[model samples]
Target: MENKLMMRLVIATEAILFISLMITYVYFDLSVGFTKQSINYLDIKSTGIFSVLLFSSSFTLVQAEKNYSEGKIKKLKIWLFATIVLGSVFLFGQAKEYFKLLNNHFNISLDVFSTNFFTLTGFHAFHVIIGLILLIIVFILTLAGDFDRPNSTALSSIGMYWHFVDIVWILVFTLVYVLPYLLK
Candidate 1:
């Protein structure tokens, strides 16, 4: 019960922060307008691919939970490993995009678009890294027979967090990549 309550509070607080950043992003977009350079520089296709991978982690996590509930520790570990791999790939994609932007001189300080864009996406990426770390820890613990029991609160808590991170990515991906591309 305490674990769940703590996870709920963390999720609520994080939701507020992400919401504020998203609103800030929209405020900048409406106030300053997205410059042609910014619009043209946005890579919808590549990021969409990564976004799919990130979203898939949520499903893999569910599989892990199912395996845990059925007393299949090895299967649970495999699913968790799959979740970690998918999330890592997504992060790699995000980093690749960041490097490409920096190489093209489209950095955080470039303009309002760049500033808010990086801020919003950077926060999301940070959350992903944290999620990855948590998942890795859980995986290690499971390997050591720490979570052999069915009532694993740690796994449940991590599931909530991982799902939250994935949902946030969906919103960010739509706002940063999809909406801009469609409107342009």
Candidate 2:
């Protein structure tokens, strides 16, 4: 109960952090001159693809939890592993995009747009990394038979967090990707 409460608190704080960053991005985006064309610089289609991959992990995670509940340990491992792969693919897509942006000279110090873009998305990427680490640990534990009904709290806790991260990315993808194009 205590751990779950703490997790909820942590998630609330994380949501606030991301929301603030998003608001800051909107403020700067509206106020500043966009010297670079976002359409040309950002591959929205590829981003959408990666977003789908990340969101799909949520389903896989639910399967993992369900399998665990049903005592299907091997299936739980497979689902957890799928979640990890999807997450890693999402991270890889982000890294590729970051490198492309960097090569285009869109560094953190470039301008307000660049600054807000990097800060918001960078923090998101950091969260994704943390989620990946947590999931990896859970996956290893599952493989080692360290997870069972009595010991499933950690997995459930992390699953909540993983789902939260996926939810945040959905918002981020909408705000940072879709709306801008529509607004343009």
Candidate 3:
């Protein structure tokens, strides 16, 4: 019960964090001119692709949690591996996009748009990195025979966190990638 309570607290904290970032993004966006010229300067296409990848990683993570709950260790392993791989792919896509943006001189220091853009997305990327690290730790635990129990609360908690990260990406994708294009 304490663990469950702690889990909820952690989740709530994460939700608050994302909410704050979203609010900051919206505030900054509205403060500036909503002109097509400003919108066209962003690399929306690359962001769109990264959004897709991040969203897909959420699906993979759900599968991992499902497998873990069903007591199918082998299936859980496969699904977790899939989640990790999808996450890695998403990170790689983000890195490539970042490099492209830098090469094109769309750096964080360029303007209000670039600064906010990089700050929001870069903070998200940092979350993804932390999620990846957690996944690896869980993977190692599973491999070391630490999750052989019939009902592992630790497994479920981590799974919840993984799903939460994915859900946060959904919001990020909508606000950072989709909304900008639509507003443009």
Candidate 4:
């Protein structure tokens, strides 16, 4: 009970953190007044592909939880591993995007757009890295027979966090990647 409550509190704080960052992005965007060409710098299609992987991890995680409830240990492992792989690839995609921007001499110091863009997305990527680390630790614990008995709410707490991360990304993706391009 205490752990679950603590997780909820942490998630609430995280939610506020993401919301504030997003609001900052919007506030700057409104002030800067970008031209249509600005959206062209972002490769929406490529990022969308990677976003799909991150979204898919939510499903895999639910599957993992389901398998755990069903006492299907092997299947749980497979699903958890899938979630980790998807998250890793998503991070890789993020890094690739960063590299592309840097190679083009685009960076946070460039202008308001770059600064807000990097601040918002960079924080999101940092969250993803944190989630990946947590997932890895859970995997290690599962392998060590820590979750075999599953007496309490260990797995579901992490699941809540993983789902929250994915949900935040969905919002960030729509705002940063989709809406700007489409509005153009």
- Count of clashes, each model: 0, 0, 0, 0
lDDT tens digits, residues 18-117, model 3?
Answer: 8998888888788874456545666667767766777777777777777777777777777778778888888898888888778888788877777777
Q: Where is model 2 more than 4 Å wrong at Cα?
A: 33-39
* Error in Å for residue 143 of model 2: 1.2
Model 4 RMSD vs true structure: 1.2
- Tens digits of lDDT, candidate 2, 62-162: 99988888888899999999999999999999999999998988788877777777888889889989988998987888778777664547777888888
lDDT of 3: 0.76
TM-score of each: 0.98, 0.94, 0.87, 0.95
Write one digit per residue (lDDT tens) for candidate 4, span 1-184.
7778988998999999999999988887888765565567789999999999999999999999898888888888899999999999999999999999989888888777788789888988888898889889878888887767555577788888889999999999999899998788
- Sliding window of 10 residues with minimal summed lDDT for model 1: 34-43
Q: Best by TM-score, which number?
A: 1
- Looking at candidate 2, the ten consecutive residues that score lowest on lDDT are 32-41
* Rank list by lDDT: 1, 4, 2, 3
In lDDT terms, which candidate is top?
1
- lDDT for 70 in candidate 2 is 88
lDDT of each: 0.93, 0.85, 0.76, 0.88
Better model by TM-score: candidate 2 vs candidate 3 = 2
Report how far residue 7 has shifted in candidate 4, in Å: 1.1
lDDT tens digits, residue span 8-97, model 1 = 999999999999999999998998898977878878889989899999999999999999989999999999999999999999999999
